[model samples]
Target: MHLYTPHMLLAFLLLCLAGAAFPCSAAPADDGSVLYSTDFTNAEGWITNSKDRFYPEIETGRYHYLLEGGTGGYSAYTLPQKVNGQFTLEFDVTPEKTDDGSSFRFGIGTDKKDSQRGPLLMVELANKKDGRLFYLKTVSKENSLNLVGSSPSTGSSGATVRFEDNTTYHVKLTYYAADSRASIVVQQQGSPDVIFTASAPVSGKIEDLTNLYLTAIGDGTSGPQAEGYIDNIKLTLSPTHAAGDEKDAKNNKGADETPAPVITSAPATPTDEPTPVFTPGPTRTPFPLPPTPTPTQTPKSGLGFLVLLPALAGGAILAMRKYP
Candidate 1:
């Protein structure tokens, strides 16, 4: 029998227990912070008083900001928190249907005086007669800085965006400090992996700074009164370096540590000649066969039968046996 030592038995039991535990993976660290977030099913911390009345409500962990009809529709949010550096602003926007059109705008800056009025960096989504997405900006008192249209490289030239009624659209804005560039990306819900990226030059002290406003604006532009929903507004500050650049650096360092695969010469084929063939000698034949086997006579048992049996059997066998 074999037995395990006390230490070995304890180790084996521990190994069994460890195997039953759930496998775990290292969790990625959260490197960003939320400056403002809301699910607008109900009205909270949002102002709806303007030339175009906007009503924001919060429900089901999502915020829906309703827009009233005809001209100058906007909503503003005075975020209790603020941030600077390279930050990303993200939210979902849904437009409502009406007769007099709709527009949406979000602002970020150092102003919390009032929703309808403030000094801030603004981004506007205005629905034009052609139903295109217009990117506009307002700094200080200079409103309507169209970076696209009639302005030469001033505003985004109004990219045509396909809008669906009651549908949710994800909007993300990323700021790169080193290059002084800001990019906006948008995608529709439940769609293929299609992303639209638009970029603009960033200037006027937007990097490595602090304290600003993060807001949303809605407008009804002439044709149909538009109201939209918003949810999950997240703002994050990321490193200035591009993700690809960091990955490339890591790959170069790994290449320095690991050796490259080498190609080797193929094995040489056998070159020795086969041995010369040699003929064999003549074959031999055997003689005739014997008769079939016959039964032997039985012997009576006695006190000396066992000892005499082997001697008698050997004598009979020797009388008929032949040597090879």
Candidate 2:
């Protein structure tokens, strides 16, 4: 019996651990642009729906931008700056009690004029009939439209957070791409940090186009008195981590740890007899052989034979004694 030594066992274990740890390739760093930021307290480049009744106002050191339906419906703030790649847009939002089933859109993208040939990504917050916050995606391609998720209630683009009336909530939207794959992450204000992520394919050809705009769409279902507030619009680009590369790294590591199956060769068979060969021979005729005949002897009397045998034995004994 063979027993494994301590050193050999330790080496085997170390090899397994090393294979698991150092298997996959690391992802390359991201390269992109960082853009503009603003807190609309001074109402600089922002345009409101109505001048007197519905407009952006500064309160408690933060901007309170309002959007109403019918009387005051939809407000916008267009920026001169544009961005692409890994970027972040953060702001605060507070929905009013009278807010109907309207949606609030945030992030940077092209307007309706350049819809056909540019980049557009928007994160929309809309209230469903159940009063829960639902998220939607609208990418501009000749026309802007909503994208639905695998399930009916959930969005295919990003995660949504429920809104409380008159309650302030900080929101952030992140857009990044890796290996031609793009993704968005949305996180809501002051709670246990839960991140909602959505992904889609990125077109490699469209690299030069950029458009930045913020908008709010109104709904008149919850009476004509619906209202919402927006504040602290900031934009900046940062390094993005690749989603597919991360998964590849994990799978590669797992594959490296698994041992390959051993293969053994079958035993060879032995041959005892030589292989037979067929050769051509000349034709011949058979020959005959002569036969031999046997002879028979007759029996004598018993007394005569016994006497002759005794005399012959006595004479032989006497001759042997004389010679000795």
lDDT for position 198 in model 2:
42
Flag regions of model 2 displaced more than 4 Å.
1-34, 68-74, 111-119, 142-152, 156-161, 177-188, 195-197, 200-226, 238-324
Against the reference, the lDDT scores of all candidates come to 0.44, 0.43
lDDT (tens digit, per residue) of candidate 1 on 188-222: 76653323334454434453223333233333234
The backbone clash count of each candidate, in order, is: 39, 1
RMSD of each: 32.3, 40.7
Model 2 scores a C-alpha lDDT of: 0.43
RMSD to native, candidate 1? 32.3
Q: Which ten residues in a row have the lowest lDDT in candidate 2?
A: 284-293
Candidate 1 runs further than 4 Å off: 1-30, 41-44, 47-52, 56-61, 66-74, 98-102, 112-123, 134-146, 149-160, 207-224, 239-324
Cα-based TM-score, every candidate:
0.49, 0.50
lDDT of 2 by residue, 28-95 (tens): 43443345566665666655555553455656444443433333333455645444444556677666
